[model samples]
Target: MKRNRNFSLLLFVVFLGILFITFSVISVEARKYRVKKSKPHKHQNDRNGNGNRNSPGPAPAPLPHYPTRSTIFDVMSFGAKGDGVSDDSKAIIAAWKAACKVSGATIEIPSNFQFFLKPITLQGPCMPNLVLQIDGTLLAPPNVGSWPKSSLFQWINFKWVQNFTIKGTGIVDGQGYSWWKYSSIYFLQKNSKHIPDMKPTALRFYSSYDVTVRDIKITNSPQCHLKFDSSRGIKVDNITISSPESSPNTDGIHLQNTQDVEIHNSNFGCGDDCVSIQTGCSNVHIHHINCGPGHGISIGGLGKDKTVACVSNIIVEDISIQNSLTGVRIKTWQGGIGSVKNVSFLNVQVSDVKIPIMIDQFYCDKKFCKNQTGAVGIRGVKYDRIIGTYSVQPIHLVCSNEIPCTDVDLIDIQLKPSPGYRGFHQALCWNTYGKSQAPLLPSSIDYCLGKNGDPVKRIEKSHEHVC
Candidate 1:
């Protein structure tokens, strides 16, 4: 009887244990259900107030400038150290993402801070007219090791964004010393494919529209300090771009497949062209710029690799170029088909420039180029009130042999040799048909012509293309 009673007691304890285990499992399942039901909605988040009720769709019309109260997303608030040594790219990107979702938003990089950044692309079809208010310095990494494999083409890129304004007095510093050194060695060896096919541009806006970049300073670019590719409605004002004169391919402002651009009141000192207008660019106006220690404003070396390029209606006026390579130039390659027309340079002043006025259809930067017959057509180019001091010749016009340049005009031109002892100054011309107005200096412009190599009579001037 005692053994049976002990067995019953053991059965009772096991039953109590099973009951407790069952209740614990049910409690765990209930908690899981509650947590799942409490999750936030997919489109709305409380952290940044993103996906709010009034946000516009993709590619909406530009909003009025700073409508209502601006929502500011300071990078410092998003975990940026801003000490120039820490990697602030992720924090800055977080700020941008939050700011891009709201209208009249600003991503502010405050003053007295230096944000060290690697290659970063701020891509958007985000809220229109967003402003990047930069008041601090943005410094790039010092070496190529910091660049990712995919982001070798550009250091800072704004892609597919519209109505964006980048304003304020900040410095964009690209530490390009290592890149310049490596590129120099590669050119000397001529066989190493180590560096990527194209060096990275400092800042590039690709396929963006209605962009305004103003009141900023950029320096030490690896290549092409500022570039606008396949973009429209650009306005650049009150900016300064500087790079070492020996830096390779560091153009101040490079435009390709872009149109409707106006650049004014800027300063540039670089290795390559101060402003390079490449293929498919039209309706451009560049004025009131100060350029030095670089190649002057140029159009083309275009239609490369037997391609067709069409550029028209460009006006460059009220410019000053000092201690530069070439002042105003139009260059195209051989074996290319296209036309560059209705271009005018007015009120330009150059000091100690190499060549003040140049038009070279056989523009070959390489050591040797195969001679080809087909060439791009150049017509209706006018130069007016271009007074300068030149180191080399005053003008050099070498047009295409197959299709000679036509309707070229030079008016009120005066160019003298720089203050030095020695070297004759003469104008060289070939296969270009043009007329020169009176008061042209040095009497060398008499060579400037018609199809029969005679001075073409000036007809009534047509209305110039209004900017």
Candidate 2:
């Protein structure tokens, strides 16, 4: 019995020893993570050389005070009604005028309030570092007839602004139903003598520099949702642009003559192209974009009306286009000059898309599209890692016969036609010279590639580009 008692004591001592060791290790680890000492002398050895490493510390020092910047100009204070019915254009103008003069000022449109505004221009070469912080909803006029001629092109235009940023968690509602009906009627009228100009885009930036627009929800634009014209160093990220699929000319984001633009992590579903990179654009990087129920992103529709369009150094990667008409296309009208070069589209995911890849030189929507000789030069184009399921044609490469595409390279391209469509998927090629280094659907890649002793183009319009 005594021996058993001693055994139990031994066991208990061992368990206690284990627990004590574990707690000691934990204490050591906890001591490793330490806060800075307020009194430096306390970290040193005590007079008797006891472990003073973790002495009873003094109270923590107070946090240093920072200078607060109270340069926020609230739109409500400018006599703007937050109601959805009142016209707040003048109030917005007044607030902008106040904020534009102060350096590093933020013009805030607070949350939960809908400000109804008319067409207005926010002209600025404002003091350094201005921010248009939008937290409330901004609604456009519902009737097109009520709009003036001055607002035909765009509803809200930011002109000549530098070092500007418009961002917030809010909505810019275009109320585009009326404009869509107007455009549809105008386009449908047979033998109509005068075709009025295109409808207004929602937000337009003209001749602006160093602009960043992000985290905003924009919807129902009458024409193009967002347009950046003659701007540089523009960044658009994490925005949602949406409209009905049947709406006409409602492009999500359009960039013309803009340079150094980065558009990433955005979702778009509009009538027209999700992102339209037009003529005179350069150094554009677009990635992580999700587009659907709309025309996929495109470069050109350029060279229209026999004009010169020069674009270069563009990259589009990691894009997904679902249920769209076209994906990753470059289109230019006939009878034009200049070139599109050094462009790359990589890591594209296409699902239920009509045309997965296209480069057209005869891009026209007019009923009587004039066929001409002059064409835009296309060179140094690359398509890589483009894997998709095409609903219609897998590929369409219709370059200009006069100025054939050159140095075009395709690699890692795997496409298959979607089920329920047994139309014998095709890849049509005309006047397009390119090297395909990857496998394609149906194993008939020679049709779209001027390789494997394929005939060089002279001039044959047997199959015009399928839009």
Which digits, one per residue and each the tens of the lDDT, describe model 1 over residues 1-467?
A: 99999999999999999999999999999999998766546665554554443453234458779656559989999999999999999998899899999987989999999999989999999898799998999999888766787987889999999989999889999888888998878778767767655678889999999999999999998888999999999999999999999998899999999999999999999999999999879999999999998999999987788788788999999999999999999999997887888999999999999899999989998899999986777878999999979987899999877777877898899999998815557678888887888788868886665543423212111111211
Pick the TM-score winner. Answer: 1
| Decoy 2 TM-score against native | 0.81
Candidate 2 residue 266 Cα shift, in angstroms, is: 0.7
Alpha carbon lDDT of residue 459, candidate 2? 23
All predictions: root-mean-square deviation over Cα?
16.6, 19.2
The lDDT of each candidate is 0.87, 0.86
